[model samples]
Target: MAISEKELLEAGFSNRDVDTLLERLSATGGTMQGFIAALSRRFR
Candidate 1:
């Protein structure tokens, strides 16, 4: 399954952040967990 632009927007992400995330996902073959983990680390 793929993430959609609507989902990102609904999740409260700004358009720029959404675009960056989408690019990262494409570069990593849709691996979202790592991105989430990285975000967690940043906030922790």
Candidate 2:
């Protein structure tokens, strides 16, 4: 399932957070897995 802004927001993330994620994804070759890994490191 593709993660949507609305879905992330519903999951308690703010728009700025979502935007930062997208920016990071783009920086890291736009890979979802990379974004996920980055997030994992963040909440750890």
Candidate 3:
């Protein structure tokens, strides 16, 4: 994904949370859709 820290902040995640999300992205094979799906798993 081509996301920046600025974009992540603008999306409402804190700096610390952005790192966590980035790590999650890596764990899920680094696709934005994979990231969203991982997040969905958390809320479900």
Candidate 4:
């Protein structure tokens, strides 16, 4: 199941973070796991 924007917001992500995540997913073909990996790399 895909995570919703409401879920992200409720999970503590800001609006900008949500937008960035969506954009990243779109740019790389939209996988939530991949997005998480990329996000992890970004922070590390």
- Better model by lDDT, 3 or 4? 4
Best candidate (score: lDDT): 4
> How does residue 23 of candidate 4 score in lDDT?
92
Off by over 4 Å in 3: 33-44
In model 4, the Cα lDDT at residue 20 comes to 94
Worst 10 residues of 4 by lDDT: 30-39
Taking the tens digit of each residue's C-alpha lDDT, what string does model 1 give over 1-44?
45567876898999998889878889878666667667779999
TM-score of each model, paired residue for residue: 0.53, 0.62, 0.51, 0.65
| lDDT for position 3 in model 1 | 52
Q: Candidates' lDDT values, in order?
A: 0.78, 0.78, 0.77, 0.82
Query: Candidate 2 vs candidate 3: which has greater lDDT?
Result: 2
Worst 10 residues of 3 by lDDT: 31-40
Q: What lDDT tens digits, residue by residue, belong to model 3 across residues 1-44?
A: 55577887998989899888778778867876666667779999
Candidate 2 Cα lDDT to native: 0.78
Which candidate, 1 or 4, has the higher TM-score? 4
The lDDT, on a scale of 0 to 1, for candidate 3 is 0.77
Candidate 2 deviation (Cα RMSD): 2.7
